[model samples]
Target: PDECPLAACVNILAPCRSVYRWQGKVENTTEIPLLIKTTRACYAALAARLLQLHPYEVPEIIAVPLVAGLPAYLTWVATEVLSSP
Candidate 1:
């Protein structure tokens, strides 16, 4: 939570019910997944923060690069995250 605070970006908290096999056993769990919408620039910082605070030995930190987006929306995302030159 401290890693990616609400103030860090426009975050969406999603409840995820997951079922998977681990240690030769089927497991089911409900997890709170955070959908964080921030700029590419913030990715590294955010990931580092997550590593520092995440309880899991290996946290699930995955980033899908934005290949296509609405022009206006893309511009807004860039504007929101770009550092001042």
Candidate 2:
């Protein structure tokens, strides 16, 4: 996806299946999730870009907060993304 602020990201097949009702039937499917290491300053624009270009009417985009991590790893993540808001 364009406009992503991360210098690198991890994409993997999600472990759990997504279940929902569609047209009076239950639909279950697997999804590939992308874990992007980006700065908080870039999240809004990044999310907007994904929504604009996404094929689905509704895409599942979730941002998990990083409460704690190795200082070096966190620093690496911060450096990979833009510093300016």
Candidate 3:
């Protein structure tokens, strides 16, 4: 267990190959993705912190609304994110 004030949890996924166009050129790179679990209330802060810490000029940061989740799990996440740091 760890103290994460801005997010309930974060999963550092395995690195994967990425291909995209940037600065008018196609690029291929290996990137590590992060799966973050946080409440809407904490999203802004989390994103800001990531931007401050991330080395990349343009990092991929997006939120996908959960369509459905186990009720108990969802409540736990919300509680964790809202609890005092």
Candidate 4:
């Protein structure tokens, strides 16, 4: 929550089970994904901060561009992020 203001908002999703291979072995774990809404301008700072906070040595951090969205909502995201430090 402390890092929320870095972006417009964050959507915490339900915990999901993940299965992946690491160090030549398969592993399973429960993880709660977060959907963060922010502009491309803010992505670098947000990702850098997440890297500092995440526990994993290589946490999954990827950006998917918004091809379409409600105009007002998109504006709000820009406004909120721009207004932040």
Candidate 5:
């Protein structure tokens, strides 16, 4: 078994900044991001689980569909989460 705590944990160079009204005033901030890769079978469970753990009032949970990918890598992603430790 792998030493990873999750099936797949990826770190990408994502630099972001968002502007929002907090207390009747606009505020902006920059932050790093964590990109999680999970399968369709596990998406619902993962989203629900994250909602419970996340502290954001309206957390951002976005899924970007893959237009194309290597067959073997895609297969690995589909089954990785279900792998037994």
Candidate 6:
């Protein structure tokens, strides 16, 4: 968590509730899901890093493309993920 910039984006962990089927039964769970608001260019790298650092063998590394968002907010995401340059 400390190694990921998204975890620090707002200085707070995003709260989430997840539901899925497992072992032939539906289950629900609550988790501190971190929504890493990063650019397309950063998705792959961030995902790879998460896989390496995450304890789960198959971490829930899903990337939902930003089709539309407030322009200012999208710009902020881009800036937040920009590598030192």
lDDT of all the models against the reference?
A: 0.67, 0.71, 0.85, 0.87, 0.69, 0.70
How big is the positional error of residue 2 in model 5, measured in Å on the Cα after superposition? 9.0
Between candidates 1 and 4, the one scoring higher on lDDT is: 4
Runs in model 5 deviating more than 4 A are 1-7, 12-15, 83-85
TM-score of 1: 0.64
RMSD of 6: 3.7
Worst 10 residues of 2 by lDDT: 1-10
Backbone clashes, candidate 5: 0
TM-score of 4: 0.90
User: What TM-score would you give candidate 2 relative to the actual structure?
Assistant: 0.72
Q: Find the candidate with the highest TM-score and give its number.
A: 4
Candidates sorted on TM-score, descending: 4, 3, 2, 5, 1, 6
Candidate 2: stretches off by over 4 Å: 1-4, 14-16
TM-score list, all predictions? 0.64, 0.72, 0.86, 0.90, 0.70, 0.63
lDDT of 5: 0.69
Task: List the candidates ranked by lDDT, beginning with the highest.
Answer: 4, 3, 2, 6, 5, 1
RMSD of 3: 2.4
lDDT of each residue in 9-84, candidate 3, tens digit only: 8899999999999999999999999999988888887888889889998899999999999999999888878543
Off by over 4 Å in 3: 1-4, 83-85
Clashes of each: 0, 0, 0, 0, 0, 0
Candidate 1 clash pair list: none
Better candidate by TM-score, 4 or 5: 4
